[model samples]
Target chain A: MNMSRIVRSTANILFPFILVFGFYIIVHGHLTPGGGFQGGAVAATGFVLLLVAFSPDIIRDKFSFNSMKYTEALGLLLFIITAFVAIALGTTFFFNWLANGGIIFGESVAFGANPGILNSAGTIPLMNVAVGIEVIGAMGLIIMYMLSGIEGGNKE
Target chain B: MKSKEILTAIIIAVLAASLLLPSALMVFGSPQNDGMDSYMIDNGQDIAAVNNIVTGVVFDFRGFDTLGEALVLFTAVLGVTLMFRRMKEDEEYEYE
Candidate 1:
């Protein structure tokens, strides 16, 4: 269906909740079954909903091409750097030193959690976060570019 | 929506099973080694350092495929840019 004003208004009201719930799934992924890709797809859904419901220009100012470019590049760099750090530690690539070492980070870490628990997936958690950021950023940027009506090779 | 009927049916069936399998396992299977988890714990470290068995399996043990996926995404973006360049230009000029 074409973008409806009623749908746009409803989405505007619901977008924040969708975004928060998506973040929850991604962050708690290690403890449960969900992870970066699933959560990233969920998060991207919020944006997609906005784009589909409202005209692209309405959300254009909030999500710009430059911002998406920066976030996507940063996400890729972060993933690569994480892998390289494993190499630096003298382990095979993406060897996941953090899990072997037993570290709990980011929000929602349960106190006194032990290694080998479903909740303690080590570097995988961080990797998930990085992937989530990268996926959302890349997709959001691409969508923005398409919706913004920018021509190929145009400086603007 | 009509075109999506078959895909939607498949998706619903899969999701229903994913939801049901875990609960069924909880009733009949042990907490550990529900087939996949044991295999993961066993080979996860040796196959890759990542403690998360699934990650190791997807990103390291099976890394060749992920590389292909990234390349595919890049190519899709390039193709879209080529196809829509003229349309984008027309929209911009109309706005001005």
Candidate 2:
């Protein structure tokens, strides 16, 4: 279903901003109220807005099914490998081996309540990004599938 | 018609059971004692090096749970993709 010009223009205006907001939520998941899944859903909502405004053919041209599938696979793979690497580091499986160890993302945290540093958490942030990517891909693909499968969606 | 009446009755019974069971079983705004609460409050920051307790709990302290959840989502996505595969041979699904 094609939206009016006003709705379409508003969606065009709001699309990138929503994407940026979603990324912000994902990146700051360790320190903020939002996280990977929430951010990914937000991103998917932006895509949905675009889909509602434009045709499925147009949206499909911008984002194909294969790209999203591969992205989901890559995110899951990254998450698994990150966990296994902790095992490789002589820690137990899914261990926070990088925390407070003075490596990358290994900043020691001061005890007690305060605003958190972005670079403090080690594997958590990495995992958050992975999960965020996975969620975005999965939700976007689902929305695309459902929208395209609707009656008369294939016409024109 | 008989089956529809039975289904409607069954639905009402289920709805009543759900509504009544929750009121009888749960106490609002108060939870039972939790051992992990105090432990995480004390040591979560030192372990995860992160400020948010929930994030620490989900991604660090109980990371295996997160892993399981991720796998579940992956499986769901796979199921959706498979279930909605293109019907036409010439469809542009990009399986490759």
Question: What's the TM-score of every candidate structure?
Answer: 0.64, 0.82
Tell me how far the alpha carbon of residue A96 in candidate 1 is from the true structure, in angstroms, after superposition.
0.6
User: Per-residue alpha-carbon lDDT of model 1 for A91-142, expressed as tens digits?
Assistant: 8776656654544631222233225344454566676777778777767656
Give model 2's DockQ, 2 decimals.
0.44
Error of 1 at B63 (Å): 5.4
lDDT of 2 at B39: 83
Superposition TM-score, candidate 2 onto the true structure: 0.82
Instruction: Tell me the DockQ of each model, to 2 decimals.
Output: 0.11, 0.44
- Model 2 chain B: worst 10 consecutive residues (lDDT sum): B85-94
Local distance difference test values of all predictions, in order: 0.63, 0.85
- Expressed as tens digits, the lDDT of each residue in B1-96 for candidate 2 is 699999999999999999899678878755577567878988888888988888888888888999999899889888887777676756665576
User: Which of the CAPRI classes, incorrect, acceptable, medium or high, describes model 1?
Assistant: incorrect
* Candidate 2 lDDT tens digits, A53-132: 88776776788878888888888898899999988989899898888978888997888978788888889999999999
